[model samples]
Target: MARSLTAAIFATALGFSACLLNAAPAQAATGTITGLAGKCLDVAGANSADGTAVQLYDCNGTAAQQWSVGSDGSIRALGKCLDVTDNSTGDGAKAQLWSCTGGPNQKWSVSAAHDIVNPQANKCLDVTGNNSANTTRIQIWSCSGGANQKWNAPAGGDDGTPSGFVVTEAQFNQMFPNRNSFYSYSGLTSALSAYPGFAQTGSDTVRKQEAAAFLANVSHETGGLVYVVEQNTANYPNYCDWSQPYGCPAGQAAYYGRGPIQLSWNFNYKAAGDALGVDLLNNPWLVQNDSAIAWKTGLWYWNTQSGPGTMTPHNAMVNQAGFGQTIRSINGSLECDGRNPAQVQSRVDAYQRFTQILGVSAGGNLYC
Candidate 1:
């Protein structure tokens, strides 16, 4: 009811995206479409092709299940529209849309030549598209610039930026810098250029403090993004049980790591996925690969979690140490101790590099 209208509104808004596409168009259309050769669900099951109503299905890898993305931000399989299932455009529908008229929900972006960004949600569209033969589906996700979202377009997608290309690393660095709290360098510049809401108000000292804290945690957790896997774990299960409260169980199975902190558990995945429009149960890697999802999770943790005093400073300061604490709280368990003494010490080296980059004293107190 309300959800359907929301999707309609989203679709209508997309009709006007072309107007806003001027600021950063090339970044929006950088990917290519691989036919939906391996995009179908085998468990619940649905097969969508041109002109046919696309339906939901478990990963089965059938001939009728192939899908392809287009340079124009359109999704087509068997020559049909990859639409929202039931034509319902609710805020939290699983990635189970069917073939229908090319609406905004069906429109997507290939901003990175490897990633497909969905402008409507300001995130990337993923294959849920694991390399597996079955259990693959397409869904909108945050932009991680991971391979899943990236597509190698032969003719390339749109290039709407005033510069005739998407944002460059220099431009991105200028706009986001090491201090910008939330800025991704994709074609999102157009959408974000006017988002005065993204302005930072902290003093130079506070900015340094915040950036140092953010960098420390980011360095410790991701080894500065080096520890990240080449491909995002897109096919992991959502792991929800109907009887369980909020569909997340209360045990080890429920709490597996995800994203930088690798916030685990079916509950967290469900919550995050619901907000982001992907079915967490169907595709769990949204935590890692989706840039927007990762950012959302990071922000959620920084603002809402508390943890042990030893691993991170989640409870110490709301600014930076607290953010670090959220990481430790989420990923610093003995069970998931992938970081060794040497690796831990490496964070210090990384923090030094961070300070040099930002020209600030990265408080050595939390350094590995």
Candidate 2:
């Protein structure tokens, strides 16, 4: 919608991101810093030279990949430190295996956000061009929260995220860097039980496309997952319909947007609750308070409902109906067919970017 960013949103952005690197400093940390495509940070050729390029390689449990994080913020491997080449603070500065002298350039902070930041440069450890191919040299680039910048270093997603999911925790973090922790990867995976075939019904490419489509639409609705409730107070009391037989039992204002897909209206709560075997009509607050329930509501909408379009988003992608059909299913009435090109473009852009992150083609029919 190209909605205005609230003063409250701007004011809290800084403070909210202040904790990205606030994890207790790695104390003799004993793991590899995993990055793009699940590769590990490796020293080229296992060399101990002062300027050997630090690169991404397939994790082989090798000594070159094994790193011990220092209390003083040095990442050491092969008896050398992960140093920014020549103490450079510039973007594209190559990280190298250099003799540790505790230079500010050698200092690093492993963040909970899955970033290994060189505090001196204020940049994130990045794979040069979002490539995950082995031996791709590593460098420092401005923090973008892209998959190339995520690392499962000390206290990162590897510690808390579940394994075997199509979307790795690092990738999820990359997708919604500013998201509330309440929209957790664990919570999301837990809710997947409700729709067993979602993201699992097709070929690998189709699966990733479905996942990207769903999340792209979700990102639009929730503002990259940063917003939990609808920001417009004026619409709060208007979602209720007195004409329904249930008659907005939760209260007039209670049916306003909430959760990832912003499930609203009295009848919607009743229907979602009935399908999910919960009492959302009478206990709508659960959608806002319970992370699992919140994720489930979003999933329910994606799987079962075809609000203003001809097909469910799930069937659109899995049946090779193309990404545009998914958009039609989600918001065709207001945003499709040129009614709101900007909003439609926003969704398409997100879908393309997310499919790229998942290493899949976004496919055609990207607009309705």
Candidate 3:
């Protein structure tokens, strides 16, 4: 009797296991994605271009608006992957329609709160500027759990100008309204394009932080991007870096601090010019004369040089090493360790303001 009872119990357990194994998997969802003020995710003008903008528009139940969320971790519309531009994980990076290649940037996950997040950047798909108007571009930003970052995906297909920089022309003007004539926004934009990854090295938050850090340094270096060249004539001839074989072909005094970051020294000019495909070594004057070249030199320094710090300023920001490290990276020997507290405070003040303007937290470690 005992053996028979045990046998029956074993049979029942086996049947339950079989039932569990036979259960069907959940189906992938398809629907319209609605967000902020009832705007829908839209393909711009229903165009099929690879880089076509994914924007916010009025919900009209068009084929262009249809989207499906796949179990493969992709949100698809019009048979193309909703992709981050250049597979970039940086904040303010644009999102567009692209051929599905199974890239990480193409992967997205809908959260319990209905935020469509890019796992690669660990950020949310956001409507730029939170504007509900038609044709507002979509972008990736730090997941703030804000209404703009929330989305209703799998029930819909959803979705700027300012080609290079994320900040608008108006904002740029506000930042440097009375700046020097040599600081051209168009020129800076054009130059930044040459290095597609400049100031966009990591997640969206990091990108914005790095931009603020760089600009803050620039503000300190050039007095609000006003001076094209260093004002102290005494230091002009000291930047020759005589160890270089090519020497200061543009004359010893020509290598003074110039441009947004105030690039200095003969070797720096050569390195910046070579990297940008310009002849800055022989024509160091171009650093001050041409707006684009000037900006490029500044970016070259920001992206490449470590100065006194162990890592480049770009790396410092991207690695979450704090703004103080960036100051050290740029001029640690002179400014760090309470050596120049006022100068350090100035950069930190600019960073604070810029972060507020950027709609992100300033993060920790403000000083070296």
Candidate 4:
């Protein structure tokens, strides 16, 4: 049995309207939709064509199974809504893809029992005949509060984080095959998990570019993740700017270039620490000691700092500002304006390689 009518009424009142006919709107609830026997709701053969059948398949982290549950009540995948066949309300009516029309047949709400119910039909989305086999058809059926109708929908839209992480572990290994003494693949993975939103500030393509841009810069800075701290010990002491109010809590000579992007300066450590909820201002060595922390600091710089550039590296990549802008953002004063073409070229080369690996175009403006 489905939940009581009062519960259904409350869900309807919560605005489970069908999606409008535009590009699939940004979703509030998005993730893999898992159903009977742990199978996922998959678009057949990763196809996005209208009328494609949505079936149950093995859980593979592909775009076909990536669903965005919109606030307007449409469950969408590959930019189309999960719609009923000909707006049929009868039990066993097969579900199919259609351009979203905000129709009653497309408006679905999850009941207290966790059934995905189309209110107009007052029936739950069920695996056809309660089958759990791969390629099992999905249809509307009388609510039985069965496990086949139950699903798990995590919160937040797919902004290309883990679900859309374009780089593979093998690719990462190819980029940093030897691995730094202090940096591990696990560390990078942890950082990626901790800041899943990193480089996801824009569309899927932008996200890939941002990730590539950031890795390219870090590769140039660390000699392919080979070094944990800056090699020039003399410059370490120079990074301790005495003008700030904090006055280098880690000591006069503590602030130095360390971590993936070689985070430097007392103020920078303070800022990265504050953003990551670590006491980096007081324990500057933590950046070098903790691999995950080190990567986080690098990502912190990528996502938040504009440095000598007008925008953050993340913003630069996402806004199609060109890779040269990222160079300006990182070290424009010294590298831009023909100051250090060789160094700039090295970063660009790495970026190009990464983009090639990611199968994305490097866009334009390779130099600052």
- Index of the highest-TM-score prediction: 4
lDDT of 2: 0.75
User: How well does each candidate superpose onto the true structure, as a TM-score?
Assistant: 0.37, 0.57, 0.60, 0.60
TM-score of 2: 0.57
Candidate 4: tens digits of C-alpha lDDT, residues 1-368: 00100000011101123355756665557789899888899999988888999899999999999888754556888888899999999998998888888767786654323567775666788999889999999999877767888887755434323433456667787777766768776677667533444543334466578788988988887788877777767656677778888888788889777888778778878877887889999999999999989988887777777777789777677668899998888777767899979888988999999988877889898899
**Which residue pairs in candidate 2 collide?**
none
Clash counts per candidate, in order, are: 44, 0, 14, 1
Full-model lDDT for every candidate: 0.40, 0.75, 0.72, 0.74
Better of 1 and 2 by TM-score: 2
115-194 in candidate 3: lDDT tens per residue? 78775676789999989899999999987778988887763211122342445566667767678877877877777644
Which candidate ranks first by lDDT, i.e. highest?
2
Q: Arrange candidates by lDDT, highest first: which order?
A: 2, 4, 3, 1
Model 1, residue 102: distance off in Å is 51
Q: Predictions ranked by TM-score, top down?
A: 4, 3, 2, 1
Worst 10 residues of 2 by lDDT: 1-10
Tens digits of per-residue lDDT, candidate 2, 1-368, equal: 11111011111111001111213323366678788898899999999887999999999998999887755556788877888998898999999998776566776655544667775666788999999899999999987778998888744212223333468888999999999888898888778756645665434576678899999988877888887777877778877878878898878889777788788777888888997889999999998899989999988888877777788888888778888887777667766888978877888888998999999899888898
> In model 1, what lDDT does residue 326 have?
32
